[model samples]
Target: MATSPGSDIAFASQKSMPSENLRTKKLPLSEEEVFYMNCRAVYLTVFKSSLENIISKDQLYLALQHAGRNPSQKTIDKYWTPQTAKLNFDDFCVILRKEKPTSKAELLKSFKQLDVNDDGYILHTDLYKFLTKRGEKMTPEEVNTIINLPNINADGKFDYIKFCKLYMTTSGQCLKTALERLQVDSKQRRQQFGSHMEELPARDPSSVLKPSPRILRNSDQETLSNRGDPRASLLSTARKFKASVTCTISMAANGNQNAKLTEPNLKDWPGVQSRGCFFLEDDGETVSHQYRLHMAQRSTVHLTIKPLNLSQVEGKLSPWSSVDTALYILKENEDQVDPQLVCFTDLQHREGFGWTGELTPGLYRLLPSTSGCRLRKERTPEPEEAQLVCRDDAGDLFLTQAFKAALSDVFDVIDLDGNGFLSLEEYNFFELRTSGEKCGEEAWLLCREHFDTKKNELTRQGFMDLHLMEANDREGDPCDLWVTLRAMGYNRALELKEACPFVIDLHAERCKPRLKAVRMEASRGQLEKATCQSVLLQGEARAMDGYENVLVHTRSWDFRITSVIENKSDNKVIIHINNELSKNCVNNRGLNVFAVEVAPQSSMVCQHVMPLNEHQEWVHHCVYSLISS
Candidate 1:
């Protein structure tokens, strides 16, 4: 009638009475004999060792098998005899996977969960509430010993959680010993069950293993309990168990295609730089399951980093401080995915800015960028531009796909006059402007003096150049767009996408501010042809690199450059350079080649660099004119 799915079904059946009666019979063995009996049970169950051997010869294999199975000490001694105390204390630890958490906060939380009553004390009722419903109540002495504390706390009440923790750590040895003792009790019960079976009719072997009270009818429980205790003598002869540390190795992928597990001797293993191991859907080759390795002590294992064929790691390495080089392996073939770089909880870790360490002896990962020395400020998340790149849920990079449709639209619209390539006039119309008219007042003001009201048509490369020149004027020739972008490191983006063809539609939308148009008679050889641009802008002036200078607006301002050209006498002279944002300060506009100080016979290239500040605005005009005196 147990409602809970896990409730004891054996206890419910009347036919199981024989097993119940057999289970209740106590064995005559002393506590010590009982303990070794438990050890024997574990050894036999896990490593197939017998009780006689476990009690006499402290075989290492039996101990290893015990540890590997992680059996409780009670289980360990379940089938052991009196003489099996030869196991060391360290050897007992092999049977345990986790040492309880050492952190105080975590321990306290565990205690509170067990202490169901808010009264702050763990009483018998609280203990019942904490343990399984079917668990038997502990005797008064057992409870006191389990929760023994000198001061119990200021309130003089034992904190069950704290007591359990203290007991688990301090009394773990004793508890293990006690569990081993229980093994003897279980054996006595089995014997009583066997005796009761002798009185019943022959049955199947499997049925004998099943619980039935009838099996205990003929068993003399009291006489068995009176038998001379063999546990005491066995405890005296058996060696006391000692605890020791060990390690485990878990491979992320079993049969790798390119990577191989060299001989177990890890001292000479070479680690390669690779993408390492990553989780994937269960495709037989790349298993994504997390493999675990828990070692007895952190220092017992030494991880060595051996450099393989790769130099430093190929990707940015600063962010992954917790990753070690052993977690990575270079790919064997170009067609294959890059060598895998993997990391684990203790197997891989970063100890310093550039240095990482691993504990697994094997060549687990490839060491990447040695130190933070190679990391540039722009490469990492700095205060100025944090979260620059978009990342997906799994931290995979998201690439911006080029707008092919946009490009097609641009080619369709800008290829005006059916020439298949945009002319300066055609480009102006697409930008919402007349071919040969000055921008309206609102647009002109937005543009600095870079826009010339006098000139009607802007030749190609005039759009963004004018905007750059004006923005520079306001900032006192402070770092302009090109210089700032270069310094900020847009070069990396350009390189990653350089191979993709430029989407004309995207260019129309994103590159609007940088384009320009101006009237220039091109050499006859340079006719109409659609081609890629290679304009390189380097100075504070001539901000527009290749496009026509199309000004959205205009404002009167001084434009500066690296150098200025001066004419000794009044004469028409023109100085031209590609990708230069130079303008004359006199009219607060583009330089007038005719009005410059040019002599009738001689001309001068004003080599003095123009000052970008406000105060120096009048110097260029004043210096040459005054010297005429």
Candidate 2:
């Protein structure tokens, strides 16, 4: 999002925080607590494991993959399988309390065991069988959580070596802190058998993996038919079927149909902001074509990683992302980023990871990143259609010759003073027409930073760079740029669209405004070079016996006339104004010709000056007369 034709900046806290106890410092968890944390740290890694408040051996296996540390199945069997009971979340708290932190050599050896073919890759089937068939079986959902999308390729192989290398870089303390952030106290496990309740709402008991689906007998069916089973097992019971808690990650916008708009985050992150997904598009993190959602006012972004075949994700060298990628939300302004409100949703989320509170109105990019950190772009080819339009070559930015030529002509049109640089006023004039927006001073400065500029005015190169920046932010989506192109009169073929050559606007209260386009005595051509320049009260008013010539002049650009019309006729009179000469400059809902009817002996004023398009500017002299109604 290197500024979506917009900007960035991290946030500074605006609100004064209420004072708290100064002397007390929070202590870190030790032993089993830390181990339990390391297990739960696999939140997104184990698919919906966060919500259940408990984990299975299958879950532990996925967590181990994430930590790049795997223990022997014997260790698992001795410490875990002895209890033929549902595994509660608290059961693993001390699984490692007595043992030292697993060593790097042990972790490496653990990974080596799974590479049966010694091919330097861990196959998905090898892991799926190892975790499910032995120790505690994990649901396929859990296994898929760790092995899906950006992590594993279509052929189902994991680069365990690369993952292990990244693991080695982090120190023991950093790893411990990352793991224990959420496991501060004893987990509020499910209230068992009506024991002294803690006055908190109860959730469904965490599903325990069944060895196999229990087949129902005829007697069992008859008994069920007599009394319908209201509650059915929600965990995987058979080899192919799973019925865990509802998958909230896949919920559509309808999930938040009553999404009320709020501005909570605005107080924390104030200043010039953008208005779309907050991703650094220049960083090569592009969304799938269909997923580039724009919210005019409000929208719920469904951020699922596109399959490798659909879109190439360059996370092979990214350790954390390839192992446990997440979609991070960050607030951006003027090239500064403030993770004002930060949260991570699993790249393979199933625990309903979503905006827990009101997502304040502003630009927020959901980056599929190694912790939502902006990285240098290692981009793939942009969207096919956009590149086709621009036809970029390697390192050429692919800006097509046609598009560049069109932009050059556009710069000349908007430059206004023949200085070869577009001033703020001139640029805003272009901006207002093409995008219906004004590029603010800060935005202009950003333009300077990214592109070529002189004396603060955007140069021709800067203008081109600005468009390229927009295209990059959109991940090669062509709609936005095309809007500007078409507005500037570029057609699909990049040819200038046909336009009406002359335009005039005026309103007179006591005078009927009449306009006409007279051919130039020389080689039929436009008169001058000023763009959208309008000088007010720049006209002469004269009275004649039969009619009046209320004249206004075009100063080489778009102009308007404002005057009053008076009627002293005994009967009603009709005066008509025609803008046929200025049709191209009229916005939608503006008419070419309008009549003003005045009552007997009364005067009528034109309601508004002629409405015209700023896209093409002009000024014209006016003459008026009356007709009997």
Candidate 3:
């Protein structure tokens, strides 16, 4: 080597250097590996020596730029400062790794697999099935609504690109984790419930197993140390047990039974006639109607009588009471009416019954009848006096009276300024009085927004309209009224039950359709050749008024009516269709006679029209019976 170092000797000398020795120990290093190692060595030697094992802010900026990482101002602020500019080797590696670009191929592949049809588009149904197969018990409608969002497209269809973009963000990752946990829980639930588990077509399990790069890197192993397990919570366990017990009880009660069961008669039961102050002789001529039979401090009895002939009549007795004697007559007469007409009368007095100064509510079944009809009591808890006053069969008359009464009472109480209209403050007070809580900001704003500007306040008419709209909104579902009542401090189960019926009846009066049926007959012409027009009408009278002057289209001919004549005395209406000269008749001189019979104050529309006969021999026919619309 002294004479002229041979190649082998030179190589050996080079490999023996400190840096080379480190590389030689870790043989077969990749290019990247070697580069990083050399960079680390140089960094420690030059940067650490001068900077006390830390790189300065300027040094880090230069180093990051040299390494091809364009750190933003935010990143600089997060990791670099005059006093804490130096970063340890570990911290340096972590920042670089985080900054490293991630390949979207894995996420793309997962989304492609979820798109079952391979059509490049994922529909809500497709997503639903995929999630369900993976054990997510999510509603298809909800999934559909979410997937069809505005940003994705006007049509709400999702493609692979959009899917990846949505799920790759930090917020998206959080959502994905939550959905994954939900799916897992759903799968577990299916297994526990013995429900059928839907399986997806077999494929590479690894394809679905691949997670987003961010999720994988940041995935934390949830420890029981901080939050503990939800299943271990006493309240959660109790709730589950309670739900299970309720389900079991419901199933047992719904199972087949051998004999009809009836409530036992109380000992020394009072005779039906002597039980209450209200009495009706069994003349059997009285038609079925809603009637209040008795009023007591703690109990009230309501009777729904359907007088069928004299000796045989159908009746439903609803007795709300804490006393067993109050229900004795209901039990005794349970066999007198058809089982279908019997109503539930079993009402147990629970603790929260009169908490709101309202009636107690309960549901009792009139033991199974011979006909296998078991009627349960209605769940409306109106005051007996109110029920007596509010009659469903009274048509618009009852509504007008009730509305007037309610308006007068509410106006007297809410008009603090002695003005005809209510100011915002007064309206708020009224709301508080009615619901036991002030109206929310949004509700108050809505009320003010709809105020009559001319009056500059909520007038009686405006108030009525607002309340009517609110009532209409609640008429679709009776349960909504129950929830509202509960929110107004009527939270007891009995109280809700007692109040349900009254609230339902009150709202139903407005929404209820009054049209019974429409009947028509033409007097002249080959009525058989004439086109018959029949219109099955429904809805309120005011709504149908628009159609009153309109001509009704028929298959063969058009029917024009000037107006409908209502017979208030008999609760019937006469519909006169404007007739033309009988063109089909051999003698074209006679006018066609048309007549229709309808319920009084009914919103009637032409339902059906048929030609009588081609014979033209003075034929007369009328609609025999009226059918409920």
Q: Highest lDDT: which candidate?
A: 2
Model 2: residue 147 alpha-carbon error in angstroms: 94
**How many clashes would you count in candidate 3?**
26
lDDT by residue for model 1 (26-111), tens: 54654433433444433433232232222333344334333222122333343233544543322332222221213435445545
10 residues in a row with least lDDT, candidate 2: 226-235
lDDT of 3 by residue, 520-539 (tens): 11111211111111111211
What's the residue-level lDDT of 139 in candidate 2?
63
What is candidate 2's lDDT per residue for 151-262, written digit by digit as tens?
2234878666554432343223224433443333234322221111222233344532122111111122222110111001001111111111110011121123243222
lDDT of 1: 0.26
Find the 10 residues in a row with the least total lDDT in model 1.
527-536
The candidate scoring highest on TM-score is: 2
Using lDDT as the measure, name the better of candidate 1 and candidate 3: 3
Number of the candidate with higher lDDT, 1 or 2: 2
Where in model 1 is the C-alpha error above 4 Å?
1-41, 44-48, 51-156, 161-206, 209-275, 278-353, 356-629
Off by over 4 Å in 2: 1-388, 391-397, 497-566, 570-572, 575-629
